[model samples]
Target: MPLAEIPLCVWRKRGQDFVFQGQAIRYWVAGQGEPLLLIHGFPTASWDWHYLWQPLAQRYRVIACDMLGFGDSAKPLNHAYSLLEQADLQQALLAHLGVDQPLHLLAHDYGDSVAQELLARHYEAGVEIASCVFLNGGLFPETHRPVLTQKLLLSPLGWMIGRAFSREGLVKSFRQIFGPHTRPSESELDDFWSLIDSHHGPRIMHKLIGYIPERRVQRERWVSAMQRGDIALRVIDGEVDPISGGHMVERYRQLIPSPDTVLLPGIGHYPQIEAPMQVLTHYLTFRDDLVSPPRKAACS
Candidate 1:
C-alpha cells in the first residue's frame, strides 16, 4: 500500500482516549481476544505496523499507537520524551484499554527500550507477562555503537543540524536502516519524510535520541529479571543490521537464558518492512508455542 493511500486521518479521528503522565494520548485499537501491542521505533509512527497488523489482528486484539510526539497523536513540546516517560505513557495507555491480563508485546528499535522499562516495572509489581517479542533492539547501550547520524541527533547541536538538513539528507539517513535486499520504495520514503515534516519534527527527533538512558548498573538487574523462567523472551534479528545484529543477539543470549533467536539473512534493521513474511512467520510460531501444550516429560 502507498503512503498517501493510508487512512491516517480517519485512524486519528477514531483513536480512543488515554492519559500519559497528565497528558492525553490517542491510540488505535482493532480486533479482539488476547491483547497484542505493537510499538514503533523512531521517526515513524504506528504506521510501521501497517503490513503486519491485518494478519496479526485476525487472531489478536491489535493495538498500535503513535508514541506521544509522532504520527497524529498529541505532541506536547513541554514534556521531554524520555524512556521512563514513554514507559509510563504505555502503562497508562494499557490501563485505558482495560488490559489487565497478561499479553504479548511486540517492540522494535527504541520501542524495545520502552518495553524494557515496562517489563521491569511490571515484574516489580508482580504482574505477569505472557511473552515478549523483541526485534532489532535490546536497550544495551554499553554495547550499542550508534551511527554518526545518531550521534549528531543525540548531541547538543542536534536541533540546528536537523533543521538545516535537506530532504536528500533525510532520505540518505533513512537508507542506512535498510539492508541490501530491501531498499524502501519511493512512496515509503515519502511517507517517512512526511511524518518527519510534521510539526516540531526536528525538536522531537532530538529529544527522542537524547532521551535514551545510558547503560548503567540497572542493565544487569533488568536482564536478570527478564531471564526469569516465567517470562518467555524471543528475538528476531536482521543479520545485515550493523546496529543491532549478531553482537546484540549474543549479548541477549548471554544475559537471558534460552532466548529464542532467529537470524534473517539478507535483511537489515527494519525486518518488518524488509522481510515482513519472515517476521510474520516468526511471530506466529512464537505465539503458537506459547499457546501449545508442552512436550510430555520423558518416561523413566
Candidate 2:
C-alpha cells in the first residue's frame, strides 16, 4: 500500500479559505447534518480522521482542519500556537463556514486541550454545545505525564531535535505513540511521515507542546464547566494509552459528575485509527442516545 493509495475516501483536499487571522488556515469538510468538528492532535494532520471520516460523514457534517502549524495549514513562524490562539482560529473557521448552530465536538490528544479551551469560552458566553466527545488525551496538564519526546520538545533542546526530525525519526515516533498496537503498515507509516515532512513541520511540533499551559491552574474550571449539565459530555478512552490511561478517566469522572466513559480494551491512544469501526459505533450510539425520546416519568 503506497502512501498515496491509503484511501483517504472521506477527506478531500478542499484547499485554502480566508478567515480573520489570515489565509494560512486550511481545512477539509465533508458530509452534512448537525455540524461535527473533528480536531486532530499534535504532529498529525486532519488525516488523523482518515478512517473515521467516511462513516461519520455519512451521518453528520464532518469538518476536520489542520491546526495553524500542522498539515496543509499555513505555518507562520512568528505566531504563537498557544491554546487560546488555536481556539480563536477554530471559532473563526466555524463562523466562516456559517455553522452558527451548536456543534458536536470530537477531539483527541492535544485537540482535547484546544477543544476544552473553546468549550470553556463558549460556556462562559452561554453558547449552546450539542455534545463533546473526548478520546485518549490529557485534558489536565497536572495529570499528564509528558513522554520523553514531549519533554525534549518543550525544552531548550527542542530546536535541535526539531531540526533533526527525519523520516526514520517520524516513523519511530509514530510507533512509540502507538505503543503496544501493532506497527502501522509501511504505507500508513509513510503517509504520516509525508505529512510531517512538510516545511517547518518539526518547528510546528515544538510549538504545539508550548501551547499547553500548566493544567493545575485551569483544571478545576474545565471540570466545573463540563459538569454544568447543560452540555452533554462523554469520553471514549483507549484503555492502554500510556499518556492518558484509566487514571485519567477516573479523574474525569470524579470532576464531571456522571460522565459517560467507555474503555476500549486492547486499543492504544489513536482509537480513531486503530479501531475505526468501534469508534464510529460508540459515536453513533452517543448521537442516538441524545435524540432518543426520554422515557415518561415513572408513575409516582
lDDT of 1: 0.73
Give the alpha carbon lDDT tens digit for every residue of 1-300 in model 2.
211222543243454566547646768788989899999987777888877776787899998788878876777666666766777778888888888888889999888887787678877883456889999888766667667777788788887877777778866666665637645788777677767766667766776678556455667777667777776677888777777867788777677766688888777778888777777778778787887853121100
List the candidates' TM-scores in order. Answer: 0.88, 0.90
lDDT of 1 by residue, 64-175 (tens): 7778787666666656667766776777777777888886899998788777766787678834467788888746866676667778877788877766655586677767
Where model 1 places Cα greater than 4 Å from the true spot, the runs are 1-19, 22-24, 214-218, 293-300
lDDT of 2 at 175: 68
TM-score of 1: 0.88
- Candidate 2 — what's its lDDT? 0.74
Cα shift from native, residue 23, model 2 (Å): 3.9
